[model samples]
Target: MNNTHRQIAVIGGGLSGICSAYFLAAKGYEVAVIERRAHAAEEATFGNSGLLAPGAAMPLTLPGAFATFAGRFQEEPRVLLASGADFKRNRWMRQTRQAQQQRFAANKLRLTRLSAYGQELTRQLQEHYAMEHENSSGVFHLFRTPLEAARMASLQEGAQQCEVKHKTLDTAEIRLLEPAFSSEAALAGALYYPDDIAGNCVLFAKQMRNAAQELGVSFHFSSTVKSIQPEFGGRVALELESPHLDSRLTTDGVVLAAGMQTAELLRPLDTPLPMRALQSYSALVPVKNPDDAPNMALFDDSYKVAMTRLGNRIRITGLLGFMPPSQAIPPKALRNLLKIAGDYYPNAANYNQAHFWSSTIPILPNGMPLFGPTRHGNVFVNVGHGVTGWAAAVGSARVLADMVAGEKSAVDTEGFLPQDLAA
Candidate 1:
């Protein structure tokens, strides 16, 4: 290790990468960010559902998740099981099912702590910089059927055990929360984490990048990562190929956060990171009437869709899991989204000019990120955030940075460490 002058290289310049770079630079380490995209936040960080939800601590493979998976198969343009026999898809389901057992109870406890700590980190960032990314509080989950409502009540109990605050409401209360919902299907609701917020992930990343740059963090956009070579004494040599030229760079340590491509990059390194590149779609539609837009974020339990209002733009993002990325937005998924939107908020019917966006969620079977140091002396991993990547980015970055620096973190990261999942 270079004691006098330490150079750190981070691959992938999305939210996780940027957050890692920001914290490293703040700690006075020389930082270099190598991004393949023409711009930052161009991949998974682009146009997300925009929920900075801290209460999203429930594991995706809860006991009742099998039931939800059954629901997923029935829905067209489905959000689960992209394609059967897809190596990644099969592995994810198998691993996810395995994680549902009691042996992994500690994992869920750690996840809850990390998520809660993440919420505090987000609050501090907002206050420290006064960023403008549509940070709205008040998140509600609406259920259409009694069974659906009952399912949520059970999940709420789990959430409560995690120390997340929530309240159950009847049909009239649901109406007060979002009067636009006229369908008799919406009979009950749950509102929790009044402080849980929403915002554009891309916007927040850009803002953080700007701040990081001011602190002397160097960002190399449009540079594609070609290879990573293990150098002498816990150092790394990075080969980068760009449109302009091919070049090699060296650093004391490396952080891999290349989203779905991370698995491909590390394959040759003999690190089997089993991950599912679950594809998800989102649309930003022009709002014809301001009244029709939701003032707060709402999760439609029946449809597995999340809707939020970003000023004049109403963003609806859902539909996860799929094989070959859909060439374009699936019509069935889009129609279902609009239908749900209209069902909950009648004014949303006036929505027009919807722009479709899709991203590959790097899903781990445990539904938690394979975050923290790898077996390699100088290498670290920070991808596989799944749907909660946006929510966990900043906090996880802080945790990973602390591990690289050999410091103890405020939150317990034992279960989230890469070695635990590698087992």
Candidate 2:
């Protein structure tokens, strides 16, 4: 299939959409990305923990997970959930219930394959195009107790099946690897994934967008698509409005990667995409003493929080809300993050000047992203990546572009079909 004449429109400008445009443009297609923000990565692509660990793509619906999280959400102030009613949220809860241990394992395995594929593509992009994102490798999954070590059981199995390299480290070994863990509280064992990486997804997306622009991919910033409808000859048309322009647009193919608004985008086409939004919070506390800060990415599994060192700042990201979009950060949530930071790496950052951020992530109950065709073969989706969006961006784009170009994808497309989680 010669894609030289195709004009592809991507309905988002975040990591997933930019990566999609990058690949499509690389393949000689006329690509255009429509972003509502003034710049790229201003939404879900911003403020993530920045760890690109394929080993971290575990499913949230493990056996007894619902019970555990139900109790945890009720007991732990950091573990958040909404009691309000949302049609999609309620349906998603039921689907999560159906995705017991068997489905959880299946989803995790699928995610592992996609993660491996995406990591390689990400590496290639960085090496080939000179993309910058504060690149670094090695992440520590710290376990403070034997019970925490036990929780790593299933993830370790999946990592082995994926043939990823890792090392199990004891307390002394962990301290040697990262002295900030020298505190008595940091004692237990941990699994160190050597290939896990950390980088600014927003920076990577901006650089990739520049590369795409050089390849003649048009980007329309501050443009929001009002509606999408199927035109004659199997084309999808977009009615867009912006502060500067209100117009109609059409393309040979459309890829929905618009983050939280993706389901709304597809609704006009009557595509029943089963995804609910989870508003997440994070804080970027400036490093007051960089010399004392831990350089390796850290994941406190017990608290379900992650901390990463990004240059002179400590990026602490965690906390999940089962509700829709909002910028308001709960005081209790911020306090919880501050506590985590202070406990593990005391005096490493200046909490007084910490920067807070919030964004919505689209989650499917099955914990796998949606890919391939929607109601129409020409319409594809690459949303529902959740936290793995940063790691899986490039590979998802590569696969989406291939499918749109009538070529086979690089990863297995079995569980990635459109509306696979619409149960």
Candidate 3:
């Protein structure tokens, strides 16, 4: 298929959409991106932990997950539940529980492969474009107790199967690797992935957008795509609701990469995607002491929190609360994140000057992202990446572009099909 004459429109200007446009343009297609925000990476891609750990890409539905969720009301809880459960939330929980019993291993493998591919593509882009976004290497998974470490046996198995290099380190070894770790804090052991990396997600996205533009991709910011309808000649028409633009635009194909809004857009096309939004929180603080700050990324397994060193700043993020959209940021979630920062690296950053952030992350029940054609012939989707969006975006976009170009994908596209997750 010759893509030189094709015009592709990508919905959403976040990391996924930007990468999609970049790959499509690289294939000799004329690409345009429609973003509701004024600029790229203004939403979920704005503030993330910046972790790109394929070795640590495990499924969320582990054994004894329900037992853990039962402690949502406890002090410094890792997971929070809504006071009132809606039908969508209830259905998501039910499916998640079912997946816990049936799909953990498969989902873990799927995520591991996709994340590994994405990390490679990310490094390729950085080296090829001479782009630097405060890139760092290594990831440490800290466990407070033996039981906490034991729960990751399945993840370790999956890592081995995926050939992801990792090591089980004792407390002394962990402290040697990261001497700034507090000795007073309880610690049993840690899993260290030396090949994993961390970088500034927003900076990387903006740089990639520039690279895409170099390939002749146009970006239409503050342009909201209200609806998508298939045209008579196999093209797709998009209804726009931008203050500065015309009402409609038609293109050869449309890719839906909008987080949370992807499902809403698919509904009018009669494609039902089973996805739920999870509210997550993060805090960015200026590093007060460089020697005391971590050299790489750290994940506290017991608390389900991540602390990442991004240039001169430290981003502490955690908490997956199934709550209402109108609800304010929960005080308990903020306290838990602060507690982790203080417990592990109290002198590393200016805690009082931390900037708090919250965003809704769309996730599938099986903890795997969907990226492929939908029921509509010319419409494709690249959404539901959850918190692993940074780790999986590039690979998903590459695969999406391959599918759209009628070419064979570099990676196996078994469970990533949009119809595989349809309700």
Candidate 4:
């Protein structure tokens, strides 16, 4: 099947959808992106931590992870489980436990490979498009205690097995690399991944959108996809609703990359993906003291918070709350982020001028994204990336494009297909 002439509709305007549109357009496919927001990257992409750390992109369900999180819940209480979060009743939680017990090694390998491949593709795209988005190299994973470092045994082993370039840094080395780190804070050691990167995700998305547009891709901003139905002759019909017009657009295929809304769209097609929407929070503040601000990305292992330098500003993001979507940001999550910011670099940023935000991040049971085709022939999915969506976006998009074109993907496609979750 020659897919060069095929017209594909991508249902999202975030990083994943934009990357998919760009990759598909580059492959000679006629692509049209339908975005609900007036502008791109207004949701998850906008609030992304922007830490492209493939070395740290391990599955959350690693060995002893449950116990570690339990300890954290008892001590600091970073994870918030609201009233409606019934762990036993939630199928996603049940499958996550199963994966933790049985498929940790496999899932970790899959994610590591995809993350590394995504990093490569990101560089290639940046060079080809001559795009710059406040990019910075290297990431430091800081630990506050030896106990916290011990909890990462499985992660370290997995990184070693995957051949990820990393080195253990003592306190002196850590201080040498990040002189701005607060000396009063407790410091055990750090893991330095020199290959990882940090940059502005929204800027990258906009740049990719521009590249896609130059490749003859059409973008329909402020357009909403009301419904997607399979039509005759292997075509898909998208019922669109927008202020300008309401009509049905037909295409050869449909890619559901609408972040949290992807699950809702799949329900009508009888292909229910067991994905949970986890609320993530972030605070973006201007750098008050350049001498005290971080120069690159840093992840606090104890708090599970990521602080990344984006040009003159800093983005501090962390905390996963199992709660329903709301316009109001969780005060507890905000406090945790603020505490991390103050603890790491107290004089680096102005806390009063910080912009607080929250977004619903769709996560799967196995901590891996679902890509490629679904049960429906013309319907595909590229969602459930959790928080690593930014790290894995480009590779996932390339894999999806290869799948649609009936070509082999450069990386292994195992455990990423929608059918892999059927078990």
Clash tally, candidates in order: 3, 0, 0, 0
CA lDDT, every prediction? 0.71, 0.75, 0.81, 0.80
**Candidate 4 structure lDDT:** 0.80
Tens-place lDDT digits, model 4, residues 1-423: 346438999999988999999888878889999999999988778767787878767564322235534665443455656755475435556677788668876777788788888988888888988998788888888877786676466666777876888888876776698898777777777788888898887898899999989999888989999888998778888899976655988889989999878999989999988877778788999999999998978887666678999878999986677777788887777777888789878999988898988888887778788898998977999987655457787789999999899888988988999998876
Which regions in candidate 3 have their CA more than 4 angstroms from the true location? 1-5, 61-73, 144-148, 187-189, 326-328
Residues 116-203, candidate 2, lDDT per residue (tens digit)? 8888888888888876678778888776557556757677778889887778877677778788764655646678887888777778
What local lDDT score does residue 196 receive in model 2, on the 0 to 100 scale?
87
Predicted model with the maximum lDDT: 3
- Give TM per candidate: 0.89, 0.91, 0.93, 0.92
Off by over 4 Å in 1: 1-5, 60-88, 101-108, 143-163, 187-189, 243-246
Sort by lDDT, top down from the best:
3, 4, 2, 1
* Candidate 4 regions with alpha-carbon error over 4 angstroms: 1-5, 60-75, 84-91, 143-148, 151-153, 187-189, 244-246
Judging by TM-score, tell me the better candidate of 2 and 4.
4
**Winner of 1 and 2 under TM-score:** 2
Better of 1 and 3 by TM-score: 3
Clashing pairs in 2: none
Per-residue CA lDDT of model 1 for 1-423, tens digit only, reads: 233446788898998899888887887888888898888888888746777775644454422335545664355433544434555455567677788555345565566667777778877876799887676777777665565566564556556776777777665775676665454554555555566677777888899898789879888888988878887667788888866644988779888988877777777788778776767777778777666566778776555577877877778875564546766766666676676677667666355567776787777777776677676767777886654456677788988777777777887786677788756
